[model samples]
Target: MLRYYGVDLLDHHRGTLSARRVWVLLKHLPRDSAFARELHGEESAWGLGEHLLASVIDHLAIGNWLFTSAHTAEGESPPDPPVPVPRPGVADEEDETPAASAGEQDLAWFFADL
Candidate 1:
């Protein structure tokens, strides 16, 4: 692979032969920015470091292993059904939606525009 790229991958980093290369090498890879970045871990793994393992999964396109385009909720609820009963001596408060931060609201609007 380095020969094709006109550089020795071994020399790219010194004293490292473990070769933490991502899966799905140049084979059948389209020359698209998204595909390249996903393989390179640029905008992936939530920007956390130590993502060499994740880059492999992203390159392989494994549905269960890679990130999906599904709408997933991060919060978890109680396993049992809710028991609608107020606590003793508790007063009913007015319901109100939490105010989102400006950054959060801006990101939401940006994605909505996209």
Candidate 2:
């Protein structure tokens, strides 16, 4: 069953920083190790709850940027390099935001097309 869910990405700094800290923590601690378990319970330190931590770990791993040996007791495998996810991408020029309407006369608006 999926464990982590409902992670708040609001308060941009806190959320993103917390995720980065967790990633670093995972790099040092083996998955499901005692240290990880302790930190997961201590929400203040990790800045996330149990489910949120699990969700963050899952997303990073799915993107192949994080690895965990939690599934096995031996911790036999080494961490794998991140694998790029195949994405349906749009050309940058095509994806640009539509230019502002002509009536807006702000400096940014004047430069919008440029």
Candidate 3:
């Protein structure tokens, strides 16, 4: 998962600073530590919630790195768009603005309560 997101644990200078920091945290955190127990449970067994939380944190770090790199890249041409241009007569769903769905609202509520 870390490699998929360009985090190079073997090389200190390879990955982004934020990603490296995340790697350090995960690497140094003991399985039976108080922080781990608090985050999970007394047994420190990972459940679905723990997996999802880790994934969200990893993605957020990658996103932050991307934004910072884009702004700091001096005189570099921006990369080509990932998606192709929309056809003249065809409506692209990706171009549409979506209202918050029921699931999104529920997820927001869940996090708020946490």
Candidate 4:
């Protein structure tokens, strides 16, 4: 069933598989039947718990994606990326005050001793 939907378990575990695709496949799982039993295997199987957990995670991801997609589908543009705030006492390029020098600096001074 998973393979039919291009969901490789390894890729899913690594988060490389698409959650929407997995959700589509999972939602179509047979309901309460011998075939479903055979597909998922015996309830006593050691891997059944892992499979169930994966399904739950996929559903959550899909739900979040759908929620965001719904807003865009309704003619709303996605929010813009956040703009960076200037540090205090820093001067803008157009101002007469000297702008901070551009270079890599050691950040160890910013932290307190553990």
Judging by lDDT against the true structure, name the best candidate. 3
Ordered from best to worst TM-score, the candidate numbers read 3, 4, 2, 1
User: Against the hidden reference, what TM-scores do the models get?
Assistant: 0.14, 0.16, 0.28, 0.25
- Residue lDDT tens for model 1, 16-91: 4323331223333343334443443333223333355555545555443233433344573323322333222224
Tens digit per residue, CA lDDT, model 2, 77-106: 746654433222212444864343322232
lDDT of 3 by residue, 17-93 (tens): 45446545644566555545444444345545666776677677667666766886678765542443222223467
Q: At residue 49, give the lDDT of candidate 4.
A: 58
Ranked by lDDT from best down, the candidates are: 3, 4, 2, 1
Instruction: Candidate 1: list runs displaced more than 4 Å.
Output: 1-4, 15-114
Candidate 3 — which pairs collide?
Answer: none
Question: Model-by-model lDDT, in order?
Answer: 0.38, 0.42, 0.50, 0.49
- Candidate 3 has an lDDT of 0.50
Instruction: Estimate the TM-score for candidate 4.
Output: 0.25
Residue 20 of model 2: what lDDT? Answer: 52
Worst lDDT window (10 residues) for model 1?
A: 81-90
Model 2 misplaced regions, further than 4 Å: 1-48, 65-114
